[model samples]
Target: MEQSDRAYQRALREQLARNELTFAHAPIGQAIVELDGTWRQVNGALLQMLEYDEVELLAMTFQDITHPEDLDLDLGLLQQTLAGEITSYQMEKRYFTRTGRTVWALLSVALVRGLDDEPLYFISQILDITSHKKQVQALQDFTAMLAHDLRTPASVIAGFAQLLSTGPYDDEVTSIARRIERASTTIVDLLENALTTESIDSGRLTARPTALDVRDAVGTAVQAALSAAEMNEQELEVDTSGLVPAVAWVDPVHLEQVMTNLIGNARKYGGPHVRVTTQVHDRRVEILVEDDGPGVPPRFVPQLFERYSRAQEARTGSQRGSGLGLYIVRDLLTANNGTIDYEKAALGGAGFRVSLPAA
Candidate 1:
């Protein structure tokens, strides 16, 4: 051969070697299959992914190794690509290995054509996504267990605290007992709210709805909140104007908890004069709790209902209640098919509105 021809041949050999290296070391599993789905060519990753040798894989069709449940959809997409209806397709599919274990893969398939534009083979690129799927499933199970465990302890703490407060005790030690009770109550609230938020996020909460008298529920909540309001030297007002004793189909305990939280929050955060009003509409009933204290900080309103969130800037002093009140309120309302929102109060303070479906 001439000197120039020798150089050209050397360069061609180097180019071919580079191409071979690229195919062997590619990160994704790559394979070329004939129209009948027989493996014509496969890279190193492909062979390792299927746990098969080159000769073994070449003797089998793609359908032979695909998961039985996923084969139909995979074949449908392949047929579409072959029929010229689509150029390529991608899907999360599964394949079975020789050891009978399933492997999850994200498969991308493209049609390869010859110089004459006639389809020659199908090219597939696959990525193992089994690890990612396992992580997601584990996270879901953890959330469910966390929610279940937290609620029982919370109920016990709150129940015992209530028992201690109402149980017989000396007048001198009553204050200390009350403080202990308060601290325990706060912890209980935090746990309950956190668990409820997790339950809502995981779609595990269920509501047993029934007809309830809105006025009676609100009255009971107001009575419960009055003690807190009086402790803060705050005035509690109830405005049931145009609101009759209407019945609503809701979870009574959940709705009562919602009312209690909203009222208690208003008393804790509002100015000296706190007003709770109720209005009945055609389709829904709206309860508004307004306070005269400095309103919630503009920035904190958006995340007020988030778990463990506190409106520190909006709080009056170091005497802050559990930051979980609004979060619990939101969760309870959601469970009862209701909604809550915070806005500037018409009475120059913070306003919280709870809307419940009418019976």
Candidate 2:
């Protein structure tokens, strides 16, 4: 009877080992880790994700690929699972892939116990969710831009409607009508340009190139903006001193649109007048649009690029904007193989620098 029992125990041990290995080599990312955090068995999917071989992985611990910020939380949850305080846990964490990319994942882990009910190993299942996160961000950006774009003309129309009661006078009524027309024109232009976009949730804009002089486009946009600047009692300056008048292969209309938004934002949010400067560097042409108003708060800088996200400054007065201006400018710039960045203007305000590839 004792010999038969011994044989049964040996068979059970062999079966368990086979099952662990079978799980390790499965199609999805799975791993068996010791309670001490050392990886005991890693499946093929996990190995490919981390870009490590079976032999090399067994020598490392889970702490290795975990993002520094997420490490402590992971450890705490792991401790709870091992102590039987929790049966299992799931979390979103980042892992540094072998190629130096931060891989985002949804990780589920459970405690594996021995026959004596003592902690033995941990089982983990990881689902890659990086692409999902990006799509979510894009959708959020699209929604914000739409609100900003659609609201601008509506607000202008409302303002004009209020002024109509003060004007049975011919000139006054005509001026109001013209302003209303311009506001409606703005709305029509935006719709015409953007309404045909591919699904914002499923895709993004791409660039199309044509031969055009970006410098000439800047001059035209500046001329258009000068009227608004004058009305604001501000001086609009144009500096093409550094510009090389050459045609570039890009969508000239898009560049004009980018300038329109930037210059308009300057008039709305900046101090009197704005400066538009152009220059060429290496393979790219650059435009700098600056205003003398108070620059964005340091804390708000990161959020400034987010669509429809207004600054606290905008909340204080009529200086406020739809916040879609810069975001739309950025998206358009991206579609044209260009880039935009913010800086503190030497003139004691905010500055936006735009760069586009040269022909």
Candidate 3:
């Protein structure tokens, strides 16, 4: 061969090697198809994605392995690309693997042309996006659940609130009025917590942490829990013996909500009297809420911070709760660098403790 031809051949060989490596080791699946849809070349990733060996894939056309539901759309886009009306198209499509399992892919297709501007082949890049699709579906399901679960309690509160406002009632009637108000307040708190959690998950909630007097904050939360305690015929007591000047570096509003939710939970599931006590340690401020009711089931302790996770036995018996409260409480505490835990109280019931960094 002439010197010029040898140099040309060497360059061509290097180019061929580069192309082979790019196709075989590309992060995304790649393929080349002729105008008739026959796959002339496929990358290792594409072959692996389709669960097919190179020999098996080489014999099949792109359309043959496409999911039945996606074939029409895929072909339509490919036709558009070939017609020169569009240079490229991207879509979330599905294809069938050798084992018949459907694989989701984000596919981008483009037409490759020769120097004469004639269609040479089609090039495609595919990314597996099944995980993203599943996350979107999960978010949709969560939104639906929130709407349905929240509406029921809201309707109860609205119906009873109007009834209570309509006319004068006897002592018995007044007592029921109080119960309706308490239930309404509880539902409102739940809605707020749900919205707050959504904001936090979406990275929209910003905590305004400040120096807050732990004693005053606990007093405010205790006041909010009083009505709930009264409705349940439970007594709520707050003792700040060692917390007279107790202060913590935290978001006051968030901390108050956490305390109210904890105390309310104790009142709802704990026996008759629930006591909230605050104390200050060397580096942390501790708030302990204890109830006298049946303690939490041992198995449920680990999942206390998970959303919608309630003890089946507790829900079945006398302690039915929406189960979002504790989850929200934990999230709020975590955001503020605080910690909470569930334990069997020395008072013979469930104990929820919140520890915050001292101011």
Candidate 4:
């Protein structure tokens, strides 16, 4: 009895869908597609979607207008549905409209059977998603501009301040110079984070892994961040004690950037004196950074590496950050087969351990 009821309900739906006999209209594209990919009937919405006149479209098969890259995927899915392996399938695909412009749409197709359980035709529905795609692209372009316009000047300002700090100067003058460099560094970091985040979101990140001395990379990054530490009235200590230099498989530039970000973030939100230690174990190299300041609140630790996350103390600090630093660092590390972890430091501060595969 249930089987008969289901069959009857299916028949009713097919009847409503076929009401081309009654002049019903749909706001989204709908069509009856023949097994050979030709259109048996097309609604007004489908005609507008393809930018085609009814007379022209009826003469062309669906494959005649699909984007070349998407054609195989669409056909494969259709074959799966027709073979009884699936009931229906929906996918995002592209089409070339009559005017040669590309259209993106959510294309859904279902196999329809006659009362005798034999194939009749397929029902296809298309929802235009081109506008959404355009919105996303526009956002990415604006983000790119934000990164470029802000980072360039920040770099210049940091460079000049670094040069200025090298002079013999009074305590006050040197202090001001240090602060300026740190502030400029912050600007560059935030802007670079924007670009890194965009690359991560778009899956376009590039990594060139090579064997390099990680100890030297850490030392270089620490030297790069010395101005910022000084600006915070903090001392940075590097402990390479008993540490034989190890070659690690990583993108050197990215690893250095991650170290710079880590050191900067530590100096920003943690205590004054910071310690950086390096070690190697079990085919991995570890760089440990710890600060002698207040550790991250236990509650905030779980959210540390999340995008746009900032510690509560950082939110109220004199210098503000864009809250994207650690997130970008994590992404950069993962791209190069490295990893970062945060733990409470035995030095009564926050500790971060970065591990990379030894080359």
Kindly give the number of clashing pairs for every candidate: 1, 2, 1, 1
Model 3: pairs clashing at backbone N, Cα or C within 3 Å: 271-293
lDDT of 1 by residue, 158-231 (tens): 56655666668776465555666566556655555666666666677778888787877778777867755543
**Which residue pairs in model 2 clash with each other?**
24-43, 271-293
lDDT of 4 at 151: 85
TM-score for each candidate, following the candidate numbering: 0.60, 0.52, 0.57, 0.74
Q: What order do you get sorting by TM-score, best first? A: 4, 1, 3, 2
Candidate 4 TM-score, true structure as reference:
0.74
Q: In model 2, what lDDT does residue 96 have?
A: 90
Candidate number of the best TM-score? 4
**Which is the winner by lDDT between candidate 1 and candidate 3?**
3
lDDT of 1 at 290: 84
Which wins on lDDT, candidate 3 or candidate 4?
4
Candidate 1 clash pair list: 271-293
For candidate 4, the 10 contiguous residues with the lowest summed lDDT are 234-243
lDDT of 2 at 40: 86
lDDT string, candidate 4, 31-141, tens digits: 889988998889888899899988898888989999999999999998888788888999989999999999999998999988977778999998899999899989998
C-alpha local distance difference test of each model: 0.78, 0.75, 0.80, 0.84
